[model samples]
Target chain A: MESVSFPPLSRVAICGGTHGNEMTGVYMVREMQKQKMDKTGSLSVSIILSNPRAVEACRRYIETDLNRCFTSDLLSSPVTDSTPYELKRAQELNAQVGPKGSEEAVDLLIDIHNTTSNMGLCFIFYSIDWVTLHILKYIQSKMTSVDIRAIQLDLPISEAYSLESVGKHGFAIEVGPQPNGVLRADIYNMVKEAVDHIFSWLQEFNSGSTFEGGEVEVYTLVKSVDYPRDAVTGEITAAIHCQLQDNDFKLLQRGDPIFLSFSGETVKYDDEELYPFFVNECAYYEKKIAFHLGRKIKLTFPSINLTG
Target chain B: MESVSFPPLSRVAICGGTHGNEMTGVYMVREMQKQKMDKTGSLSVSIILSNPRAVEACRRYIETDLNRCFTSDLLSSPVTDSTPYELKRAQELNAQVGPKGSEEAVDLLIDIHNTTSNMGLCFIFYSIDWVTLHILKYIQSKMTSVDIRAIQLDLPISEAYSLESVGKHGFAIEVGPQPNGVLRADIYNMVKEAVDHIFSWLQEFNSGSTFEGGEVEVYTLVKSVDYPRDAVTGEITAAIHCQLQDNDFKLLQRGDPIFLSFSGETVKYDDEELYPFFVNECAYYEKKIAFHLGRKIKLTFPSINLTG
Candidate 1:
């Protein structure tokens, strides 16, 4: 692979509270704003608390999910009196830090999130951009205290829906095992450390330093598995089995127990073996995702230096 | 102490969805209803979903906390169009299973709940009624797979503000470490087994068996600790410290680290040693409770037989 050259990264935005109940990002962005962290070395940073109404209500969103409101189609959609609050907020956020697919968008957007799943610390991004990949590599190297992994959402730029998709180079730094509406010191610290490392990597990158790249493992999303439901009532009939609970990122065998029905019957996985992530996430209960299956593959990147 | 005599427990009610996001109880009550389990030996069982609106929305409650809406004052208050949905539901529930202080109330009410805390299989009740205490002992003896404990609220029967207080002899079976809006197979099973044991105990007592005198460990309500907050903003500045997180029912010594601030400072407990439970419950975050402090004690109950 040829070394890719890109313009020097400058404007960066750090967003939080996209999902109101996720306290880690909510507090992190607040703490950063409190400290007036506008400039970190060469990069100018903007601290944003997304979806204020949702954050005020301590809900995932007041209307539709704000994280899913950022696709090019939705962002450009005309607003009206009856428009969902999240969709309106999405346009406002895009206007502030991005005009999607434009050169004026922020150089990098690091949106922080916390999941109820025991995913440790993960980077979720759309497409495989070298800049985001190198940052993930840098953070993984620096933050040796916990496991660092990435989930690549295979989607076109125009179709990318998350808040992070608004930036030139963006990814969500998701750290968890923390429940919604509750915060844990360990989980909070892990996020803080990851954010600090991100800033450090930006400084090193902007300082005209050549970066050596190597193979980094990434989990490409395969498909989501919904909980077994009663055909008549549409209520879930079983729960994630004890064997699979909190076992995110573990490869699922064809015969492994995935769900335990209320009638004391075990429902085994009968699909091709794949790693599971977001296993038993709290918010996904409404979305019908018991967990998401992914294929793990290693990607190699080339060394790159910033263009003048 | 002499053995106490009580009327035969003929009518029993099992309530779920009190805090609608607590899925263990929601599913248990639904399952019991699906099986049409209305009769068990000498007892007539009623499966009730206490907060249907909240359950349908999958929220803790629509207007207010339903679990706190069951006091005599709230139950007997005149209904108005503006009254909170939970208060109205509480009154309706009282009419069906309780008229609470009246003789027509159900004999026993087993309200099931799930907490985000690590408290495993706990019984929470008001007053230290002999009937409820004996039932706790029965459950503890039968369910040896998990630690079974009890929390005494120390409130008058008239002042008790919970669905369980609606019955003549009732207590909430709280099992967890399970997050709200999530159902865990282990937690669901624990709640199911505990409910089954309650029925078995009831059947044996109804058959003229005397419960043996024994001492059971209880955590009496002491006080609640809020997360350290910023005075100006009233937002929490700290989270439950790593040392104290998930260590529910563990004795907290004076000077123990109870909170870790966002700036990396540890806030130590400055009060008397106490046992902590409901540590980091998700729903209580809005109620401003980081965790609850309690005093551990052993209550000894005398043998009691049902009077014909």
Candidate 2:
């Protein structure tokens, strides 16, 4: 593969509280704002609390999920009188820092999130953007305090839906085992450290340091599995099995216990062996996802460095 | 103490979904309703889903918390157009099984609950009632699978503010470490086993068996501690310390770390030593409680038998 070069990266945004009940991001943004962190080394940083209303109410969102309102079609749609609060906010955000896929977009964006699942620290992105991958590698190398991994959503950039997609290059940092609306000191510390590493990496990159490319393992989502439900009532009839509850990112084999029915029966996974993640997430219960299955693959990229 | 005797206990009520998002109770009540569990030997059991609307929405409550609406003052308050949904529901419930402090109340009531704290299986009640204490002793003896303990709120029966206080002799079963809006099979199983044991104990007592109650250990409420908050914004400034996160029911001494501030400062406990429970509960964050401190005590009671 040929070596790649990019223009100097300077402008960046750090977003939190996109899903307002996720306290890690909410607090992270608040702390950054309190410190008035606008410029760090060679990069100009913008700290944002994405959904103030939801944060005040301690809910995921007031109308629709703001995280899902960032696709090109939604972003470009005309605003109306009855438009949801999140959609209106998304438009304002796009106008301020996004106008996504345009020349004036921020060089990079980092949206921090928390989950109820025990998925240590994960970087989730759309497409195979080299800058985002290099940042993930740098953070993974520097942060030895927690397990670090990357998840590729396999969507076209125009179709990507999330706050991070508003930037020229971006990804979401999802750290967890923390419940929604509650903060854990250990989890909060991990997020802080990861964000610090990202800034350090960006500083070096802007100063013209090359990032060596290597075989990086990434998980691409295969499918989502929903909890077993009663046909008549549409109510869940089973829960994630004890063996799989906190075992996010573990390789799941066929015939492994995945769910335990209310009637005391174990429902086994019957598909090919794959890794499972977001296991038993509290917020996903409304989205109908009990857990997601992913296929892991090794990706090799060329060395890259800042150009002018 | 004299061996207390009462009319053969026959009518009972098992209440669940009072707080709505507590899945253990919601599912227990749903399963019972599905099985049409009305009679268990000589005892007539009424299994009720206490807050149906909240259960449907998967929220703690639709308006004000239903669990706190069962006090005498609130129950007797006349309903108006602006009455909160939960308050009205409380009155309906009091009419069905309570008319509290009246002769028509059920003989025994068990209100099932779940918390995000790692306090294991606990029995919480108001006042010192021999029957409730004996029931706790029976449950502690039978359910060896999980840690079993009891907490006394030290409030007069009429001043008690929960659904269980509506019964002639009542208490609540609180199980946890489960997040709100999420269910665990292990937690569900423990709740099932406890409920089964309660019914078995009731059957044996009604069959003229005398319960041998000697010494039972209980935790009595001392006070509650709130999270460190910002003076102006009222937002929490620190999180429960890593050492104390899930260490509910552990003894804490003065100078022990209880909170870790956002800027990496440790806030030490400066009060008397006590056993802490409800540590880092998700729901109580709004209630301004980081955890509740209690003093452990030993209560000695005489064995009692049912009277004709």
Model 2 chain A is weakest, by summed lDDT over 10 consecutive residues, at: A136-145
Candidate 1: TM-score? 0.98
Q: What is the TM-score of chain A alone in each candidate?
A: 0.99, 0.99
Q: Which ten residues in a row have the lowest lDDT in candidate 1 chain A?
A: A175-184
TM-score of chain A of 2: 0.99
Worst 10 residues of 1 chain B by lDDT: B136-145
lDDT of 2 by residue, B115-197 (tens): 88898999999988888888888888787768999999998877899999999999999998888888888899999998898
Candidate with maximal lDDT: 2
Model 2 misplaced regions, further than 4 Å: none
Cα lDDT tens digits for candidate 1, B82-150: 999889889889999989989999999889898889999899999888989998888877878799999
**Which residue pairs of candidate 2 clash?**
none
Interface RMSD of 1: 0.9
First chain of candidate 1, TM-score = 0.99
lDDT agreement with native, every candidate: 0.91, 0.91
lDDT of 1 at A197: 86
- Candidate 1, residue A100: the lDDT equals 77
Q: After superposition, how far is residue A230 of candidate 2 from its true place, in Å?
A: 1.1
